[model samples]
Target: MNKPFSDKLRAVEPYTPGEQSKNNDIIKLNANENPYPPSPKVIEAIKGFEAEKLCLYPSSSAYALTEALAQYHGLDVNQVFVGNGSDEVIALSYLAFFNSDKPIFFPDITYSFYPVWCRLFNVPYETKSVDKNFIINPKDYYSANGGVILPNPNAPTGISEGRGFIEDILDHNRDVIVIIDEAYVDFGGYSAIELINKYDNLIVVQTFSKSRSLAGMRIGAAFGSAELISLLKAVKNCYNSYPIDSVAIAAGVASVEDDAYFKNTINKVIRTRERFSQELKGLGFTVFPSHSNFVFASKPDVNAKSLFEAAKKENIYIRYFDLPRIDNFLRITIGTDEQMDIFLNFIKRYLSSLSGC
Candidate 1:
């Protein structure tokens, strides 16, 4: 009796985050975390934060930060909902929008958190398959349902479905909520924030974890019509009233103000990705067209599993998924130019030893 978990949970496959190691010498490129540090202004803001404020309860509304987010996105404060991270915002979405009778629909290959949310909340859900190239066809999500959520540049795949594809879904699915998880949009995809004014059904969730380099602070946000934001706010109030803490709020406000930081960082990542993809092609690997900060690569000549093991031996680690259709591919995050240079040299030497290479 002590060992048995909830029946719903038994069916759920929990998300496996990338490996974080205490070994400092390893060149880690598994998760799509930003390779750079936070903006200088963000560091200054956090360092200047009042120490005595820690004893006080943070503002429940996070009004100042919400307004900063609103000003940045050209939205009103009521249209923005700040949370601990994009994960919390997603959890609230399920509670506020989903019912047991209706199912949450998403691309079969998407952010792994989608299915976990449904299982945790006891919400029914179904997966819709992506196209052969791992691109999401908009028509697959047109069915009448409880709700839907998919990342713009979907995780692991690093492919994006543009604003028009999302708008097409909004035109028909106006009754239920639609969540566009823009966790990686800062680098590749155009934002759907403009559609929020026209479509009350749409919700666009963003995170500072990727672009702003604030993964440790856990700052995430969502944008929707005032009516929908109110529901998320309600659920959040009941769960954790102070999800946005004092330090995080201070850091978040600074991140939005420093627009040049993202522009520079994203531009660098894009340049590195272009060169990296070209190099991979020369190495006989098929690198998927990517807009995000990582590349999903596959080569028929080499075994993907063996390559992953070999990299670990070289003290370098990248992501390898055991899922259907993509088990042979490696999702490699774009690291610094120096890091990539090291990776490339080591990999080339290893490739020469392989029978195919």
Candidate 2:
């Protein structure tokens, strides 16, 4: 523990991830993970793996996975890049695009890791504020120097901006490499994969974690013109040559092959999200229109922190943040209808108890 670290890391506040509690049989809704397990094809893929393959190294470029994923998304192999996770993909973007002179820019309340990545690389960055309603206006980003990166259905709020609006920003800021992190896009948001043909500066990052139910497997990807992919390859070649392992490549290839499973899971999450939002609104909580798998809600009387604590006492787990505007809001991941019913039952009990108190 006495090893001296770089001075750049001294003041770095790394990201605080969602809790992974095993204390009780709670209706867990904290992280925005899929309520269901991954597709059977993914498991089957792993089951069919050869035992002797472990003796050899995984393909440095993960060629099989890259080809499968590229075909699944209708893109060329040269235009796609895969990594350990979209987090790493974003990290590479900073390495490829960011400079201390031209500050990178992202929404003030976006994926907290954006700033963390900047600090990790000693890259200066600026934060553009989202409006009072928590919507990202593309025009607000025109002034930033280095580039911009943001989630579509922005985290902790689940609000999404339209494709036309994003294209407008691309129109004006043609020089900057705009990275769209679409970790939760399948739930409802539009995919910028469609626009990559037109905008060479756009880099869309996606993950198998959220929608594909592979958080433990760690496979994320990015797509853009071949030029950008080559820059990412240069960085990837210098950093760690083998960012993906054998098992992950197999699971990732199978995950995309079973398109039916992805569609079914997305439908279920969307349905449950709507049901949860209506129920919360009926109970006097203000629910935002969520384009992601989670709903952002806040009641007038009970604060987010109190609600989080009360739910914990009842063996129900949801997410609550103490940051700026989101301090009062709770981010509840959409689970199965049965699982959510358990959570709602506990919440109803909490409200009843408060009335009597």
Q: Name model 2 segments beyond 4 Å from true.
A: 1-9
Whole-model Cα lDDT of every candidate shown, in order: 0.88, 0.88
- Residue-wise C-alpha lDDT for candidate 2, range 99-133, written one tens digit per residue: 64888878998888888888888888889889888
Against the hidden reference, what TM-scores do the models get?
Answer: 0.95, 0.96
Which ten-residue region of model 2 has the weakest summed lDDT?
A: 1-10
Give, for candidate 1, the lowest lDDT window spanning 10 residues: 1-10
The Cα RMSD in angstroms, rounded to one decimal, for candidate 1 relative to the true structure is 1.9
Q: What shift in Å separates residue 223 of candidate 1 from its native position after superposition? A: 0.3
Candidate 1: residue pairs that collide: none
Clashing pairs in 2: none
Residue 226 lDDT, candidate 2, scale 0-100: 94
